[model samples]
Target: MNKLFRCCGALALGLALAAGGALGAPTPAGFVRAQGTQFTLDGKPYRYVGANYWYGGLLATQGPAGKARLATELDFLKQHGVANLRVMVGAEGLSNGYQYRVLQPLQPTQGQFDERIMAGLDYLLAELGKRQMKAVLHFTNTWEWSGGLGQYLEWNGYTGQPLPKNPGYSWDKYRAYIAQFYTCTPCQDAVATYIRYVLARTNSLTHKKYVNDPAIMAWEIINEPRPMLPAATPAFEAWMKQTAALVKSIDPNHLLTTGSEGDIATDNDMAVYERLHADPHIDYLTIHIWPKNWGWFRDTATAKGFPAVLARTTAYVNKHAAEAQKLGKPLVVEEFGLPRDGQTFTPAATTALRDQYCGALFGMAKGNTPASRVIAGYNFWAFGGAARPVPGQVFWKPGDAYMGDPGGEEQGLNSVFDADQSTWAVIDQYSKTIR
Candidate 1:
């Protein structure tokens, strides 16, 4: 057994002390404390310099290889002052039905317990602890494997196939299934158990002590949760309220954020924050955006400027940030990135877009715009991995293929890493001022 698992009895004592005397105290040794919406390391302000982690597949499967790769990646991140990692909890790659066959020994079915996945997480947490790196633990995915995609499809009465233009195939069934997924007894129990496991294993009382360790920053409820149909807003809001409460019940000290995807002020996205921000249990508000999808900027090769996109995106961010500030919380950009492949833009255009987009966004958040101090931090969509070739298209695949093809066209965001070193010096320079 891992050293941490052997000391479960000691966890209660640790929890008592953590909740009692150390409720508002600084974390032990290298750990930091959440001061309002910001983090204080030894009483000094610490803004997160983060990257989205897309390596659950390798980590959940090939233990040794995953460890080595993660260590190297974390080392690079740490060296570059990247302090946060957003890891998925019930991602498709970690679920039993999807790419994570290796976890079958632990969690044989959706309802079964998965020791392998837990062990893998333990290993990752231990490594992060060693480096004093903070983690944003994303609990669930909006993808197909965790039954979100499948459930959404089944509820809508659509076959497991392409995206439907009109999602009204079965509005009532869709809302029921969405509610069922969140409030269902078995599902809720499983999620709560998973949260407790993470808390117990990573808490300061455990030998691993990830929660108490400086490696864990916050717990993200879901990744890009949106209503499949317009009518599902009520159910989705209720689900967020309940889930946020469930997580806070176990961990009151750590921060909490909804991994909302898309613009925040918009009707579909506003409901999530409206619920979460009003709930006293939630600690922060988060949103994700891609300029191409919102039509904020034209993706043209000749006139590739992110100024328009930055203004459009930050307008919503500014509005939400102000509202969150009034609620005494900070606004976090959970996930954002520009595509380097799969688009019609040339390599030069892609590179220009990446630099200009990142520069403009970072510039705005760094006080160049009106919403400077209201914005907290951002985690670029991805890092590492090679580009995957699209089957028949000239450009590469667009998003990160964490499980399927790590070397495929998914590495478009790798440009962010490169740009951070060279063209995007302003981001690094501005990040210093924020902390």
Candidate 2:
């Protein structure tokens, strides 16, 4: 038997003996399992062809209307062959006063869980379960609500245009805050408490009914975890190790992933990957990739060109996959996208760029040695009915000219959305069959 299969067989045997069940019990349909460098769903190799739902969880917190909206969005996604939905769970939602700035001292008698946020999550998961959809639920926000300094400043209303100056905080003081935030002790234990809560709820649901529901693909430790200040590596690593251990202790049947967006280039990046891959509790590795200066769409042609971009991205994926394979796991490209900055790309160039980038990556995956299947999956940056009209932001609402036109001035030429039936047809052709 192949070594990876043997490892998995051993794991299955251990779980069976521990549960006092028969050997060869069938894994659930739509379940993802390691197969060489790729993942197999329902015993068949599959690749992700999906879109991100950034505000799904946020909107789902609004009660009945929010639940209805979520159901509508998932139905649309299912119709479009979207096999996954990447959802965000902002840390702000968990704690009342834990904004982006300096961490407030925790009161001795604070509640451990946030009932409103938990109720929203419960509703979201119930909806996903009802639809039989899979979600890559990011436990933290990478944008304004990220952990550490970014979130701190954002909470204080520091826009990216005018980055905030440090409030003269000392590293020693900050380290203590980090410890509390990660541990959540005396303030209700943030990371460990949240993971335990999720596991308990899901396990209870499994025991009661819907044992086969695959509502969540994995628990993402943090969204785009990066060291804002010097000397954060040790603390971050310790927190990750402890959190992973705590999560695994409760939910051994599901998987765990680190939501590291691959933009921060540092020794810490490789170190984080190494630590996560070495930990047996982590089932997969995930990274996000957007071309250099992609936000500005600078060097539109070169940035969007197939050869220029794919070289670095493919190399990054390969390196991570190699690391994950050592630990009997798969590397998943959890997020990748080319945002349309208002200026640079004329309608024609924009459409061309999109097609070329998507096609090139798909082609490369097919020809590569380990095969893209070994890389688990790829989720596009986003999908929504209407885009926000911010100038530099990725999603912009359709202008008057393109109203009611599905093609929207680009016919699979260079845009992110599927321009024609042909674009999605091509995607279906190259992507691993996921149903």
Candidate 3:
């Protein structure tokens, strides 16, 4: 917090100090600090039940109706006790019929950005700050969504490859193609440039530089940055250290994290997650879980019941929590989601299993962390809010409503919408405890 205050401009610092109340410092009121293993704001312990509202940048920037929808959703979440959001900072380039592009692409080309989208992000940040809600700003991705590594690869003469959406190729081949992203010099330079651009941005509306903005709890290096395993760990870890240190050098105010999905690429070794995030610049740890993807839960194996999934998921939380204790940093299950019972895609789908899963996940964190403070709160995979999927709804269309799910995935496959009363009940109940 002191480091952050020292970086603020003298005029803003002086004014903030003059208006101080209980905090009694020049630090921005919303500045979050790592107090041992938990996060603190104004020196008071702060925990939260956040959601992945990754579509916020797209929705909030829409013409009038889009803005209204964003406002409604933000207001609703705040009123309902949803206190945190993990949103996108920007992507690599312009849209090109990509599966899950955010509504507005932040960058239209390498080293080129869209000012309107940047302003839209500025507006979103200012509004989130107004609600006293916090956000994690994730910049890039290992996936192709939002023109990620594929775009980086695309700019470097790698084209016409079988994307993840192609039925002809296996998922492994698609991931391998993306993993090659680590080897491209131009790709590496593009990400480094994008990081600098974002770090130095001065919000047009708030007149605040992004690094100094209090609404940001942390800067997530990328959404699930992956390495081509075995041979890739050393390189990936080096990239992480470089990227995290770059963010730290540019902006000393907020926290930094490697937005990695623990074990997703490393064959389920928790040590890999810890080692990848071993850098001191990485202030906290994060992991994501997809019950179905991980094969922990099978919709057709209902006869076997939920114990296998429940036990595995609970163990994951405990395993990571214990690792976090050793590292002595706060940890967050930043992403996890289960399909609704019956695995239906309809908006009316019920979430009995999802509710139970979420309850157990939240319970795992709350129960084990009181003394250790290593288990920071969870941010469920996604929140769809009031938006519905586009008609036919197989995948996203360019003009469809931004429902917080990423590009290319089936719409609302894991969204917790406004009408999911029971799900909301569980989320609200847990969120109240965080507050």
Best by TM-score: 3
User: Per-residue lDDT tens digits of candidate 1, residues 1-435?
Assistant: 234532642463355445645565544555444444444555455666577774532363455656666677678767666667777654322332333122222333344456666666666777777888877888765544344434333433444332222245353444344544543455555555556666666432246555555566788777777655555566657777788888778776577877876443235465455666668777777877766655665554324545566666667667776666666666677676665533532223345455566666566565334355446677766654222333434322224233221232332334344323443454465555554
Candidate 2: tens digits of C-alpha lDDT, residues 90-201: 4442223332221111111122445555555556666777777777766543233224323343333333312122355564444334333332332225444545555565
Model 3, span 1-435: residue lDDT tens:
234432542344344444554465455667886655667687466778889988787765778897888888899999888878998887666656555555467877777888888887888898898899889989887776777777888888877645665667677677667767677778888889998988889988899989889989999998887776567766777777788888899988898888887776577766678886778898888878777877775655632667888887767777777777788788888999987777776778778888998888777645334323576667888989887876566777777777756767788788889889999899888888655
Segments of candidate 2 deviating more than 4 angstroms:
1-30, 62-68, 93-116, 141-143, 146-188, 202-213, 228-230, 262-265, 268-272, 293-307, 341-350, 371-373, 387-435
Task: Quantify all predictions' global Cα lDDT against the true fold.
Answer: 0.56, 0.52, 0.77
Candidate 1: global Cα-lDDT?
A: 0.56
- Candidate 2, residue 290: Cα displacement in angstroms equals 1.9
TM-score of each: 0.74, 0.68, 0.90
Candidate 1 residues lying further than 4 Å off, grouped into runs, are: 1-34, 60-63, 92-108, 145-186, 202-206, 262-272, 297-305, 341-350, 368-370, 385-427
Query: Which sections of candidate 3 miss by over 4 Å?
Result: 1-28, 97-103, 302-305, 368-372
What is candidate 1's CA lDDT for residue 116?
61
**Per-prediction backbone clash count:** 7, 14, 4
- Quantify how close model 2 is to the true structure by its C-alpha RMSD in Å: 8.0
